[model samples]
Target: MTDWAAHEGRCLIHLLPDVITLFHEYVQRNPSDPESGGILLGTVHGPHNQVVHATPPFPTDRRTRCSFDRGSEGHTEVADQFWRESSGIIRYIGEWHTHPEDYPSPSGIDLREWKISAAKRTDGRPVIGLIVGRKAIYIQSTSATGKALVYQALLGNCPALGH
Candidate 1:
């Protein structure tokens, strides 16, 4: 067996169930329109790639008239509210949403979002994105960490994070 502890550097991840439940419920409630979105919170370690499938308990922001201009609106606002209203939880390590009857894999648009979000979290902290329906998640590592795009199987806690 491979000794996970023997690795040069290890990245640790913990899936927040409360968060995941919220995400699942959000997707189930809004499967088609605007999809959904939320924040990821976690700890970072050495230049390792780790993916965490977290649920967002925040509500979606449906304000504003324009769909394009609205952005993640209510959903993102919900995330912010959770952060603002919480007793004490780390800020979103990344974001996630549902993919209808599809797998939880990252898409081109998802990548673009990661690029922007990762740039914002330039402190070597990776952004974890989850495509909930198919029960999948993606880990987008920062360039400065000397790591490549890592994909892990979220059905269980296997943190291979392969490119």
Candidate 2:
């Protein structure tokens, strides 16, 4: 198992080996077609959130060649189950999705949605958004104060990012 740390000293988001494997499998399932996505579930430690698990694409999700609208159906139930199973340690930390591009960048709508989500969060912890592109994965952590820090994947097997 390996970990990736954000450049900014303020926040660190950990992507566990299983989570990484799941993301890669999801991307490989549909290399260049419709988008798929789900919520990020994990535990928050001071100044860091370790992403232990990520929900698979929901059955009700709306997918297209260029966009994905994650369905909320059964999401709350799944989250609640995770919370109970984890002894209330695991909770909704943020969101994640697949992008068709080789190196994905968040669209305007993505940023807007993330901002709104962050603002609405009552935990005061940053929300982590992940985009799994064909060649690489992008991660961003946005604080309740609206400060966002981009993270780089440190694992050698992961594709290198330009920015």
Candidate 3:
């Protein structure tokens, strides 16, 4: 189970509208063609479904160790923008990326990389791993059974640092 509380106080789990906005933005924001990506975030206030506060997509560049590897080094500007755009009412929470595949989940290598990311943080924030593609967002965590559907509203803020 990626702890729903994993990234507490550090990042935001964006809502559907916000998620969709990022999806569209990424596809158009970068000239990298298939290489472009963006971040998704929202302030999750819940009883299961509510948004007392929100944020928008913060654009960032994709950094990969190998050009073919589906991974990146997220830029700081994205996080900074979340603060700036949200009027200081929100902060960084997690990020999302797209894969050419209709379904994008963390690849084996992607999982390895996430572990490294989680290890570097001292704030106990949940580093969200989102794979957006084919009109769907799949959620994966330390305890997820398979792909958790974003459309179904499966997870919000999980506490699993990373698998």
The alpha-carbon root-mean-square deviation between model 3 and the true structure, to one decimal in Å, is 9.2
* lDDT of each residue in 56-111, candidate 3, tens digit only: 32233433322133233444555567668888655544445665555455677656
Estimate, for each residue in 53-86, the C-alpha lDDT of model 2 and write its tens digit.
8888878999887888988696677888999999
Q: CA lDDT of 66 in candidate 2?
A: 81
lDDT of 3 at 149: 21
> Best lDDT goes to which candidate?
2
Scored by TM-score, the top model is 2
Q: Model 1: per-residue lDDT, tens digit, 58-85?
A: 3343322111112444545544665566
Model 2 misses residue 25 by how many Å? 2.2
The candidate 3 region of ten consecutive residues with least summed lDDT is: 47-56
lDDT of 2 at 22: 76
Enumerate clash totals for all models, in the order shown: 11, 0, 16
lDDT of 3 at 6: 22
TM-score of candidate 3 relative to the true fold: 0.53
CA lDDT for candidate 3: 0.42
